[model samples]
Each structure stands twice: as structure tokens, then as C-alpha cells.
Target: MKIVAVLPPVVELPEPSPGYLFNVERAYNLHEYFASKGHEFVTLSDAKESLEPHLADMSIFICSPFYPAYLTKELINRSPNLELAVTAGIGSDHFDLEACAARNITVAEVTGSNVVSVAEHTVMQILILLRNFIGGHQQAVNGEWNLPKIGAYAHDLEGKTVGIFGFGRIGQRVAARLHPFDVKLIYNDPYRRKDLEAQLGVKYVSFNKLVETSDIITIHSPLTDKTDTLFNRDVLDRTKQGSYIVNTARGRIMDTAALVDSLKSGHLAGYAGDVWYPQPAAADHPWRTMPKQAMTIHYSGMTLEAQHRIEIGTKAILDNFFEGKAQKQEDLIVEDGEIVSPSYKIK
Candidate 1:
């Protein structure tokens, strides 16, 4: 069987780095194992047009969240031999679940692979925005130390209301870490996690209420039909005035232009996150120079520790498939010609 691995373009290093475990050029050193079994392994960057030619014949395709080869229904139909799709990292939102189910394609992601990494990044972004860290740092670099101007917008996390948009693994972890900050936590999720609410000391609130009440709203939900552009113009208009936002979730969850407009109009105090729309963002993307943003490339989930966990999980999935064994239930997003996770269903 042929395996096609989709990843980001490799960085040029003067010498081979032993610790660069997740480079696309090396295929996470997967060739060593696959070659031993006489299986063909191919590597490609995430661009779909370049990957189109190989889709029909490749038996397995591996992808990562950092550089996704979006598996749409059209791409699924074109790939007649695609029996398995493996996500090297967490979150399989890039794969079209309905299409994979219809095509009898087994889709699995590395569950819990980057939850802690992302949760930590979420808290960092929250603090960066709330404390005006970006402006202060910039001022220092410019050789100006004006305390009043920087402190004008700075605020403490204590006694603030923070709303979590999803109560899943990463969201729950974020809440757990933030609990020590002495902030009131509220969450909005379709499925109420009652036990977790008690454990994390959070209140369950409606989506509208969460938006209206939260001083700092952090989104941790996946991008789905119900959540696509969830924080568009109408919703942003009704958000608490001068509120801060930290979205470590999918970029499409909030409208890009609407977010820029809100920041420009001073309706939002600040915004920070690592995710963005049309990632590997263009040189001229508005967010690059948008006022009061602390955005970074989508590398929060690609930390070295997270990469090692992802590699182990990915290898385990591939081993199960090659052995004709069942994959772990927790990691299976779509299996046996059905979408197993309600979070992925088309709403």
C-alpha cells in the first residue's frame, strides 16, 4: 500500500538535526519503518493542487493540523483508493467528515496530543491581551518608557469574567489552569458538562449570555457549520464593550474582516491567538498590521513535546491499520462508514 504524507515545507538546516522529529522531508522518520515492510511512502506539502495527482492511487494519506490538506467531498470522491486518513496532530476539522463516511474512509486524529500545549497557549494569549504586553514590549524596544500610556489599557485577570466557548478537552484544561487566577469562569457548549462544571468551578451559560457578560472571551471550539463565523458582525456588535478576546480555536470561527473592524472601532480592547484564516497568511493580510493584536502563526500546537506525542499517536494508528486491527475508540473520528463524533456532524 502507498502512503502519502502531507506536511509543511521543510526548513533548511545547515546540518541534519537529530531532534527535528516532525519535518515533512523526513516524514517523521516513517520511511525507516515503512521500507522495512516494503510499503511505499511519499511526502508532499499541503497544497491540494500539487496533491491532486496522487489522490486516486494512494491507499493512505497522513496530514497535520499545522499544514492541512483539506479533504473536501470532491477530493474524497476523486481519491478512489483512500481507505485511511490519519491526522498527525489533534483536530480533524480539516477533513470533511460526511465525505469520509460516505467513502468508507477511516478518519482518526491523535486525541489529546496537543490539548495541554493549546490550553497553555490560550492562557498566555489571554494574559498578553489583558495586560497589554504587546504595546509595552514594543514601547521598550523603541527606547520609550511611558508607564501611563501602557498602563492605560492594562488590567489584571483577577475578578474578571472569562467565558470559554467550548467545554471539550482543551477548553476544560484552559479553565483548570485559569482557576488559580481568581476569575469567574462561564462556558457555553451545546452539550453541558455538568460534572466538569462542578470540578472546574464554572457556570454554564447560554452563548448569547456568555458574549454579553464575559470581560474576556476565549474560544476553544472547532470550526463547524454551526460555529463558522460565529463571531460575525452581529455577534461582535453585541459583545461586552471594550472586552478582550483570545481565540486559540479555528480561525474561521470568527469573521476576519469583522474582527479587524471591531478592533479598529475600539469595540474590543484587544485580540490575541495563534490561529488565522488562510494560514501561512499572505504578506498583506490585514491581521499582520491590525491594531491591538498579538497574533502568531498557528504553532501553538506544534511544540516539540506536542510533536513527539503526535508522532507516537500517528504511528500507533498506522500500525493498527497495517495489522488490520481496530483503532482506539477515542481517536476514531469516522469509522465503519459512519461519523462517530457528534462534534463533526454537519449542523
Candidate 2:
């Protein structure tokens, strides 16, 4: 059997670093393991290349959400021998799920592989914006120690109300980490988990209530039809004046234009996040120059530890597929033309 690992472009590591930015060390391991099993592994930097030459021999395709190789319906249909598609990390939005299911391609992701890593980054972004750390750091780097300018926007996280949208694995972990700060926690997930509410001491509130009351609103939801553009003009208009917003989820979750308008009008105190609507945002992306915005390339979930776990989990998923072992039902997104996960079904 032949497997093709489609990964993001290899980036030069920082000075004195021994690994590539995307970290292909695990891909090397998968190659060796699959080779020993008499399977061929061909790693490609991009998936745009026509697979007509190799599709007949390819059995499985491995991809990562960090640097996704979008598997469109046309590509899925072209791969005649493809049996399984494995997402190296969480989030399979790059895959055309309906197309894959129609073609009988089993799709699975390494669920919970990067939840802790992302949760930590979400908290970091929140602090970065709330405390005006970026502006302060920039001032220091420029050899200016103006306290008034820095202190003008800086605020304490303590005693503030934080609203979390989508109380999933990452969301719950974020709430747990923030609990020690003595901030009031409120959440708005479609289905409230009673156990989580009891354990985290988080209040379940309506979406509008969360927006109106939260001093800081952090999003940890998936990218689906319902969640796409979830934070639009109406939602932004309803938010408390000067409230900060953080989104570590998909960039499309918040309407970029609406967010920019709110920030321009001073309705929103700040906006910070790592993920973007289109990965590798264009040079003209508005968020690049938006005031009071702290944005970074989507790397929160691509930490070294998370990458290691992702590699292992992806390999295991592939191994199971080749051995005819069923994938963990919890990890299966689309199987045989049916949405196995309720999250996708309801959305």
C-alpha cells in the first residue's frame, strides 16, 4: 500500500534550532514504520499537484490543520484508491466532508491532541490584549518607558467577567486555567454540560447575555455553518463597550469587517487571536494593521509537545485503517456518507 503525507511548506528554523518550523520528524518516523510494514510513504509539500500519476497506488493521505492541504471534492474523487484520510492535528475543516463521505473515504482526526496547547495560547492572547502587553513591550524595545501611555490601556484580569463561547475540550481547559485568577466565568455552548458547569464553577448563559456582560469574550468553537460569521455586526453591536474579544478558533467565526468597524469606533477595547479565515493571510489583510489588535500566525496549537502527540495519533489512525481495525468512534467525523459526530450533525 502507498501513503502520501501532504504537509505544509518546510520553513527554516530559528538560529541554533535543529528542527524545521513545521517539524517533519514524525513524518520521518511514519515513513520508516510504514516502510517496515511494506507500505510506501511519499511525502509531498503541497496537495495541489495532480495525483493522476500516483492516485492509483495511494491508499491513505495524511494532512495537518496547521498547514492544511485542502482536499477538495475534485481531489477526493481523483484519488481512486484512497481509503482513509487522517488529520495530523485537530480540525478537519480543510477536508470536503460531504464529498469524502460520498466517495466512501473514512475521515478521522487526532482528537484532543492539541487542546491543552491551544487552551494555553488562548489564555496568553487574552492576557496580551487585556493588559496591553504588546504596546508596553514595543515601548520598551524602542527605549521609551512612558508609564502613562502604557498604563492608559493596561487593565487587570482579576475581577473581570470572561465569556467563553463553545465549552468543548479546549474551552473547559481554558476555563480551568483562568479559574485561579478570580475572574467570573460564563459560557454559551449550544448544549450545556452540567458536569462541566459544576466542576468549573462556570455559569451557563445565553449567547446575547455572554456578549452583553463579558469584559473579555474568548471563542473556542469549531468552524461550521452556524458558527461561521457567528460574531457579525449584530453580535458586535450587542457587546459591551470597550470589551475585549479573543478568538483562537477559526478566523471566519468573527466577521473581519465587523470587528474592524467596532475597533475603529472604539466600541471594542481590543481583539486578539492566532487563527485566520484564510490561512497564510494575504498581505492586505485588514487585521494586519488594525489598531489594538494582537494577532499572530496560527501557531497556538502547533507547539512542539502538541506536534509530537499529533504525529503519534496520526500514525495510529493510519495503522488501524490499514489493519482493518475500526477507528475510535469519537474521532470519526465522516464515515460512509454519515456524520458520526453529533457536533457536525447539529451544525
Candidate 3:
């Protein structure tokens, strides 16, 4: 069997990080493992051009959700030997589910690997926006101490109404972490987790209420046909004035230009998240300079610690496959010619 990994490169490091599992060059030290199993293994950066040569014969394809090698139906058809597609990190939206199902390709992801990592990052982005930490940090970096300039924008996270969209593992964990901050927390999900309300200090609410009332609305929803561009101009226009949005979820969940308009008009206090449209954002992506934007390349789930867990999960899934054992139920997104995970609802 042949396994190929398409991963994001960490070229910024001058020297190799033995523990940095996802670096294109090292591939988390996976080669020796595959070779030990007498299977061919290959790895490359997430360059579409760099992946073409190996498409036809790789048995299992591994990629990270942070910047995936989009497994479209066309690509799936092209790779005749792709029996399995693996996501080294959480979320498998990058896969064309219907295509995988049709092709009888089993799709799996490291489901619980990055939940805690992403949940923690979501809380940090919330505090950053609420306290105007970016502006203050800017003043310090530029060697300027403008007390009024930064202080005027800073606000307390306490006593604010916080709304969370999509209360899944990451969303619920975020609410649990933020509970001690003494803020009112409300959430909107297709399925209301009423049992967790008291335990997490979160209440279920309608979608309109979540948007209209939240001072800081952090999106944790998956990208689906219904949710793509869900936060467009009309939705942004109706949000509470000065509200903030932090999306650690997929980028297309919010409309791109509509985000700029909201920030430019000062209707939004700030917008912060790591996810973006077009994984390697173009030099001219508007969000880079949008007012009060605090964005980064998608890495919230790629911390060193999270990467290690991802490595372990990916290996576990592969071991099961190599031995003809069933993949863990939670990790199986699509299997046996159907989409099996409750987390995904693609038609």
C-alpha cells in the first residue's frame, strides 16, 4: 500500500523541529513507520502542483484540515487507488462527502485531537477583541505610549452578553472556560444541548436572538450549504452595534466583502479568527488591513501539542485499516459507502 501526506510547510524555522509533526520536510517522522510496514510513504507541502505526480497510486491520502488538499469529486475520481482519506486534524469539510461516498472511499479525521486547542484559542480571540489588545500591543511595539488612544477602545469582557453559534465540542468547551468571566452566555445550534445549559452556564437561543443580542459572537459552526455565507451583509447589519465576531470555523461561513463593510463602518467593534478564504490568502486580501481585525493564518488547531495528538490518532486509524479492523466510530466520517458522522450533514 502507498500512503501520501500533503501538509502545510513550516519554513519559518531555520532548523528542523524533531517534534513539529506537520512540517512538509519531516512529515512527523512517518516515513520510517510506513516503511516498517513495508508500504511506500511520501509527503509534500500543500501545493496542488506538487501533489499531481502521486495521485494515481497512493492508497491512503493524509491531509490537515487547517489547509487541506481539497478532495473534490474530480480529484477523487482521478485517484483510482484512494481507498481512504485521512485528516490529521479535526474537521473534514474539505472533502467532497458525496464524492467519497460514491467512490466507496472511507474518510476519517482526528476528531478529538484539536478540540481543546481550538476552544482555548476561541476564548483568547474573544478577550483580544473585547479588550482591544491588538491596539495596545501595537502602541507598545511602535514605542509609543498613547494611553488615550488604546484605552478608549478597550472594554471589559465581564457583564457582556456572549453568543456562540454552533455549540459542539469546541463551542461547549468555550462556554465552560468563559463561565468564570461572569458573562451571560447564549448559543444557537440546530440541535439544542439543553442538558448542558446549567453545567456550562450557557442557554439555548434562537439564531436571530444569538446575533441580535451577543456583544461578542464567536462562530463554531461547520460550513454547510445552509451556513455558507450565513453571516452576510444582511445578517451583519442586524447584529448588535459594536459586536465582535470570532470564527475559528471555516471561512466561507461568513461572506468576505460583507465582513469588510461591517468593520469599515464601525458597526462591528472587531473581527478575529485564524481561518480565512483561500488557505494562502492573496497579498491583497482585504482582511489583512481591515480596521480592528485580529486574524492569523489558520493555526489554532496546529499547536505542537495538538499536532502530537493528531499524529497518534492518524496512526491508530491507519493501524486499524492495515489490519482490516474497523476504524473508530468517532473518527469515521464516511465509511461503508455512506457519510456516518452525526457532525456532518452534507447532502
Per-residue lDDT tens digits for candidate 3, residues 28-97, read 6688779899998888785488778888898899988787788888888999999999988888888898
Which ten contiguous residues of candidate 3 have the minimum total lDDT?
21-30
lDDT of 2 by residue, 1-347 (tens): 88887766556556654433354444636867887899877877756674456677788888777777788888787788888888888888888888888888888999998999999999999999988999999988999989999899899999999999989899999999999999999999988988888789799999999999999999988888899898999999999999999998889899999999999999999999988867767889999999989999888988878877876787788778867898888789989777677666656
State TM-scores per candidate. Answer: 0.96, 0.94, 0.97
Q: lDDT tens digits, residues 1-347, model 1?
A: 88998877788889876766666766777889789989988888755667877877999988887777788898889889999999888778888888999889999999999999999999999999989998899998999999999999899999999999988999999999999999999999988999888789899999999999999999988788999998999999999999999988888898999999999999998988887776667789888899999999998898878888887898899999989999999899999899897677647
Model 1 — which ten-residue stretch has the worst lDDT? 17-26
The per-residue C-alpha lDDT of model 2 at residue 277 equals 69
The local lDDT score (0 to 100) that residue 163 gets in candidate 1 is 97
**Model 2 residue pairs with clashes:** none
* TM match of model 1 to true structure: 0.96
CA error at residue 329 for candidate 2, angstroms? 1.8
Better-scoring candidate (lDDT), 2 or 3? 3
Q: Which stretches in model 1 have alpha-carbon errors above 4 Å?
A: 13-17
What are the lDDT figures for the candidates, one per model?
Answer: 0.88, 0.85, 0.89
Off by over 4 Å in 2: 16-28, 49-57
